[model samples]
Target: MGHPKFPSKHYDTPSHPWQKVRIEQEAGLIHQYGLKNKREIWKANTKVREMRRQARKLTANSSDEQFQKEKNLLLAKLNRLGMLDENAGLEDVLRMTPESFLERRLQTQVYLQGLSSTVRQARQLIVHGHISIDGAVARVPGILVTRPQEKSISYSPASALNSDLHPVRPGIQETFEDEVEGKTQDNEKVKGESEDNAKTDAKTDSKKDKETETDKEEEKK
Candidate 1:
């Protein structure tokens, strides 16, 4: 075993690192989930890969009681983690994508439950200990949140975010919307200024051209 002082890598690197399509897909996923880097995506992929591998092994040993028991245990764990439904079977586990695993993360769930305005903001709140689950502070955004804990997610009692008047609190939707609208208005103003500048430049160029032509005619006279 490796030294306990240094943690081992949690994800497997891509087999074809130079593949353009795979690179684009990884970039898209990173942005979509507000992931810190491609490593988070790879970690989710690794987890899904392990689950599919186990499901394949169990499928081959369909007659073995021990394998069946282990399979049930695996399914139950996934169900508790909110990665699968109550009626989900081995097929569902086998078909699970990395997105499904990512969606179960506390950060994603916080944004989905409207606790935060965005996934990155949720991560920030979680890491800063503003978030609580089941009355305990949840400092890790990567934690796999269970279905039962979903409803229990809220701002820590001691956190300023727990107050309804907090700027980032979910109850203050108008503040967030106004901020967005303000940015949009600023962008439109900038765009209008640029367009006006372009028109002014075109008119000035035409005027200069006419003056130059008149000067040339006078020179010929």
Candidate 2:
């Protein structure tokens, strides 16, 4: 076993570091999911790669008894992570992408559940111990959340965010309709404010130009 202080790397770096397309894709994922770094993306990629490899193996040995056992195990694991349906098979596993893994992360679940306004906020809330699952604080933002655990995700009991009155907490909605209505109202309010400001600025600029023209005309006289 390795030293407890220095654990083995859980992820692999890209084989070709200078691949522009891969780099851009990873950057987009990182921004979308609020990942700490490319290492997180690499970790998800490695996990998906391993699952796909197993899927391919099971596909090749589909007629074997041992293959059935192993295939069931893999499918069960993926289902628990909410990455597959009850009737999904090896084909679905082979189709899995790093995004499938990323979507099951605790931070992503938190954001999807509306516990935070953004994925970045979800990560921050988790890291700061404001987020919880089944009433227990979960400090790891990237931990793979299970289907059952996803339902239990919420504010930690001790966290200030548990209080609905907390300033930092995003607006909570009881239904999808309410969430959409809230967002729509906020957008309209922001748009109205922006238009008002633009009109005020235009008026100020016009008055300044008039003043400049009057000053020039007076000097000529």
Candidate 3:
């Protein structure tokens, strides 16, 4: 028997060049939003596709009864996303791109709201439980945030606020330490050179003074 966590839609490939093109387009989206992988992108596409199918099915209905039901559900979802206008409909949902999905991702939200400087750091912060929605902590970087929650999203662990979102990340602290030590060494060298210069100047002045006194005595003779 297969293992519980084994391959189930876990190893699949796109069957067409159009699919390849879609994946390429989404890769740009992935990089833009700092997504972890293509799986997240596919999940968003599936949701959008299902919404489109539902809307198309309702469009064929004659009476207002079934249509209104489908429309209500669609509007509710779109409204939650803050993308539903008074006249929003199936066309609006169909028009959504990978960017729309990316915008709702916790990583993208964190970066947009200025909780983290870079997209990658924003992702790390979200995954590390440093972020929250409506006052409830969320540790999943892939969690899609809706509009009302989007405005209310915040970061927590107050002490973590002052620290770098990705503090253990390479390069930053190491570079800072290197620069600080280099400056200290440079300052000490400058101070020592300045003191030596001052002493040399004093000795030169005294030698000149002695020479002048000896010349005066010779003149007197």
Candidate 4:
């Protein structure tokens, strides 16, 4: 622990700061995830590394009496955070990527749940105290959301966004209405095709009936 005013950095900077491949990859992630900077990616990568390091240590000490207990605890924690499955093991933990951690952030979750059009908007809503988890405001966009907490994430009751008339609400409503309209159009197209097929079948039956009547008349002649 360091001074309260100047706490330690929770993440490590890359060894080579000028790698072209890495810089390009980081830029893509930042844009795709609407991250503020490369530092967030670095922080997520550091978390993944720490988790993998613990997994490796646990794997090496499989014969220890406390191994099963510690392994279960670690897997449980990861599962609770929605990062791993119930049946996941140390191997899965070792394979975890930084994106796995990033996806669990509140901003990403808000966007994924359709509460926000983008992660940047999600961040803005959270930082402005418009977002909440379980009725309590969460101002940190980078905070990791647990599976249980995720279910309760919504706009704070005090925020104007809680109302359907809010400016942001119209955008979301329009997107939903557009999807509904598209489905309705598709259904109408299918119905039209079915009606056309029925008419064709009826005309074919009438033509066959007329041919049968002409054959009967010729036989009578």
lDDT, each prediction: 0.91, 0.92, 0.75, 0.93
Compose the digit string of candidate 1's lDDT tens values, residues 43-92. Answer: 99999999999999988997999999998999999999988888988899
**How well does candidate 3 score on lDDT at residue 10?**
32
Write one digit per residue (lDDT tens) for candidate 2, span 6-62.
999988899998999999999999999999999999999899999999899999999
lDDT of 1 at 74: 91
Candidate 3's TM-score: 0.65
The best candidate in terms of lDDT: 4
| Top-TM-score structure, candidate number | 1
Evaluated at residue 19, the lDDT of candidate 4 is 99
Q: Write the per-residue lDDT of candidate 3 for residues 55-133, one digit (tens) a residue.
A: 7777777267968887788878877876566577777776876566667777888888877668998888777777888
* Candidate numbers sorted by lDDT from highest down: 4, 2, 1, 3
The TM-score of predicted model 4 comes to: 0.77
Candidate 3: Cα lDDT at 14: 49
Which ten contiguous residues of candidate 1 have the minimum total lDDT?
A: 165-174
Candidate 4, pairs of clashing residues: none
Worst lDDT 10-window in candidate 2: 168-177
- For TM-score, candidate 1 versus 3, the one ahead is 1
TM-scores for all candidates: the values are: 0.79, 0.77, 0.65, 0.77
How far residue 166's Cα lies from its native spot in candidate 2, in Å, is 0.9
Which residue pairs show backbone clashes in model 1?
none
